[model samples]
Target: METSLETVALFSLKLAYEEEGLSPILRDDLVMGDYQKDVFELLVRRGDVETIQFKLNQCLGLAMDALGGAEKPLGRELRKLSADFGEVRSMEQLNQPLLALKGYLKDIL
Candidate 1:
């Protein structure tokens, strides 16, 4: 299917919040930095995939950190998500792994 950065961003947001239950507290503590939120808004408003990917990686790292020291599998999953997100250069290129990551998150969350 045809997609834009906003499509990906919205999907990521929904998957993260709705599916993964990324509450305000989790966001305040782990993700949702000002820069990351702005980058996400840029993606939605301007379709700037490049800028948001970096921010996404940052949030992923923070989320990983919030998982604490013992959950190796969750940490690995977030790492894989970060790696896969880093590879997205175009809308077409993003679909497979984004969907895969959603499925993975389904199992995890």
Candidate 2:
């Protein structure tokens, strides 16, 4: 779950910030400090679903903007999935939506 969360953040950052001449954002990059696997591990260990979702929402929001927001088809679907993710209220319900978002982000990239 932590890995999936990290992957989603990484993919979202790649979509939001990666450019032709700029360096790509890797998981170990300083920019990822807040969204890194260890950060997520701690969140998971404490069962802090709200903070986890908040972190993911930050990245996903950027990714949605990069995808051209709700006006675009892909962005619309991303919005829907993100809404679904936002609806998750417990750790047990996190995996499905998290994986779905991760997979969508990966596919778009």
Each model's lDDT: 0.52, 0.94
Q: 23, model 1: CA deviation in Å?
A: 8.0
lDDT of 1 by residue, 1-109 (tens): 2232233333344444553434433333332344444445556456566766665555455556655422687767767766887888875565677566555544554
Q: After superposition, which runs of candidate 2 have C-alpha atoms over 4 Å from their true positions?
A: none
Candidate 1 regions off by >4 Å? 1-41, 69-71
Tens-digit lDDT track for model 2 on 1-109? 9999999999999999999798888999976889999899999999999999999999999999999998999999999999999999999999999999999999999
Best by lDDT: 2
Could you tell me the C-alpha RMSD of candidate 2 in Å? 0.8
lDDT of 1 at 33: 45
Pick out the ten consecutive residues of candidate 2 with the lowest summed lDDT.
22-31
Clashing pairs in 1: none
